[model samples]
Target: MRRSLRLLAACTIVALVCCGCGTIAVRKTSNVLDYLYPEGSPAIPARDVTLTLPLRVGVAFAPGGTATRRGASDWVNATAMGGEVTEAQKLALLERIAEAFRDRDYIASVDPIPSLYLAPGGSFDNLDQLAQAMGLNVVVLLSYDQAQFNETTNWSITYWTLVGAYVVKGENNQTQTFVDAAVYDIPSRALLFRTAGSDVRGGRSTPVESPEAFRAESAKSFEEAIDDLIRNLADGLKVFGEEATTGRVRGQGTPEIEVKAAPGYSGVAKFENGRYSGALGPVELGLVGLLVVAGLARRRSA
Candidate 1:
């Protein structure tokens, strides 16, 4: 028992060294999305004076499958254990995005029609019929994938233990992720956009002597990986015309964000709306602090 306990403690420490706080903070602190579809942009018919957007979209699980997670609970409690987002959650993501566009007077709607994955028998042909039934113009299909690196090697120094760590995300054999995305122009049958999430730390496994500790550490990566994808899509959509929808949609920008940190602390702002565009680091809000602390506690327990 003593040996087991000590091993657990040591492994837990090592995991924390690699994981930091292990919790992603999704705070859209402040952002303002405003834009006009330029005549140069994709031209579509303005059926009504209101010009309802051909804005039907989807939220799906990673194209193939989600990496299996053992030890602790998944990064997002709401996300299903497997790689897929729940039906309700997918709907929610699309709905919120639709609402955002609508708030800006861009008439849009989320197709009630399930995605190809959700409806196996349903294909693009069926989708056309379904969209026509709902009076939808274009349909957008979305998916996501992620990769994480939590490399921590241990070496004994002359007097102290050295835990070699690389917490910042990287792609390698020891990573976990969820990714894959595509946008279809139902009207023109054109491929407006298609891309995969950053599979940086592809298939790299974080094997903790303590599975629980490893999970606690890995969950943060998983959560943040997904959040990063979402934020990229959201912010990219929010800023529409300033940049191409490709690289930006996949989080390939030089700018950084400013967010809010711990109490009595100031951090980087999370999102980059038309009003503000840049990169954001970790936040230090009270809620996030609690989460981080909890991860720390879990690490300690491990």
Candidate 2:
């Protein structure tokens, strides 16, 4: 009698689980998340400084460094191009950076430096010369790196139960891309701000198949990462512009130039309670749904 009862209980539990386990078809998806790294400490103020602009802002690439060259390998490896960004994408990113500066009420106009000017490994003298020639008081030096990696994931029998009984097992391919950016004030030649962002998307084809295949498959992820990085850069610039224009300068011997740390997880990119304040997309929804279903399963079993 006890054996029959146990069998009945087992069947009842399976029925409940099966009823809840519908098809969980996780389709191909793209998701980008921007992260402003946390600040270490407050900079020591040499004195105070202020910026009043009819600010001429331009974006130029930073000169190659050991790290920069290594990062740019992603581009070289994928497209046989020495640069990480294509010429068109470079121009677009520059214009976007300039526009961020233009949005400030104190700034009159912003322009892109037509030539790819390197700052001699970020030397202030070299930057000063470049700024003067361009008639720019502020130069936004942007160095970018984009990398895509792919891996295949398999769905097991346990996952099949949640997805649906008829769900077939197969490999789902995914690719991830990254972008990094930095901003500087030319007059002071201070590193004003820096930020980085990345995105992951499921692509139709494997990125490693060939250069063309990699580019085609990962283009969306790359674009999304760039856009998010630009937005983060713009947000940080807005705050710095406000502070420089309004904040008081003190002990005016020679104001020490210090680059303020990027405001991490602040402003519109509100990362509160471990989730973005923006609308939850499919990626986020999928995660939450999985968690909820798992909890339900636990309760039912108990």
Candidate 3:
């Protein structure tokens, strides 16, 4: 009986040591630079850009790291263990972003583009094709980087006992996420503006529950970061509008870009020389006509 007890004690010690001996780290990311300028920046002659009002816009997630270069469809499967961002999640997030621009006076429509439509490291030519196919004048690309680390805490020693692995909160998880949005004029290939957001979260879970807990934490971190991105994006949009209107967007020497209503759009607004020109709408025009007739009748009576 004494020898048996000693052997069991030694086994427990080895199990406890093994439980806390290793750390697990996972990383997943999508990079806009890799997707848009994979061959490095190319030199092209500068030309003035003409922005037609009521612009059609497209939004999409950029392809992830080189491992996913096989195509975006492979991303989920390849990074499954790392808690890959799902297509459904991407669509929902894109819809929220589209809603932000959909009601703008200068925007006609905002479409959420699927990652499948984009090739990894396809560059500007890919965007050109997408724009032509989708009738998009402007495009917004979203990219993200996330890292998660799992470590055993001091409480992990309890995991030496089989039941403790299921009941003791011994695993510590840390997740960090960052997301970015870049707006571009497809025709001109000019970067109009950009915005970004990030978040970090930490929690402890029982060893048996660590996988689920880590995934949940990662998802929550992404949602929080995106919320922040939206707020910052709104501010960036405002600044871009102000700069574009004042002719300061591309600097002084650059020719002012013309802005006009699309061929069939009925809105009576125009932009010339970097200034907004508001014209009377039908209701306003009718009111002015009534006032003119009233004045003429009063003059004849006098």
The predictions' CA RMSDs to the true structure, in order, are: 20.4, 19.2, 11.0
In terms of TM-score, the best-performing candidate is 3
Given candidate 3, what's the lDDT at residue 276? 56
Worst 10 residues of 3 by lDDT: 67-76
Global local distance difference test of model 2: 0.48
lDDT of each: 0.38, 0.48, 0.75
lDDT of 3: 0.75
* lDDT (tens digit, per residue) of candidate 2 on 1-302: 99999998997676545433322121122111111111343342322333433446666654442211212211114222123445565576567666645555444467776434643333556667777787776666554444444222232223335442224322233456566665555565345556766777664332123344445545566567767877777666556544444332221343443323232422222211122366778999899999999999999999
- State which candidate, 2 or 3, has the greater lDDT: 3
Name the weakest run of 10 consecutive residues (lDDT summed) in model 1: 27-36
What is candidate 3's lDDT per residue for 157-243, written digit by digit as tens?
Answer: 676566877898877778888999998788887777789989999998886777678678877888898888988887787677666
Q: Which ten residues in a row have the lowest lDDT in candidate 2?
A: 29-38
TM-score, structure 2 vs. true? 0.50
**Which whole-number lDDT from 0 to 100 does residue 191 have in model 3?**
75
Winner by lDDT between candidate 3 and candidate 1: 3
- For residue 38, give model 1's deviation from the true position in Å: 35
What is the full ranking by lDDT, best candidate first?
3, 2, 1
| Angstrom error at residue 149, model 3 | 1.4
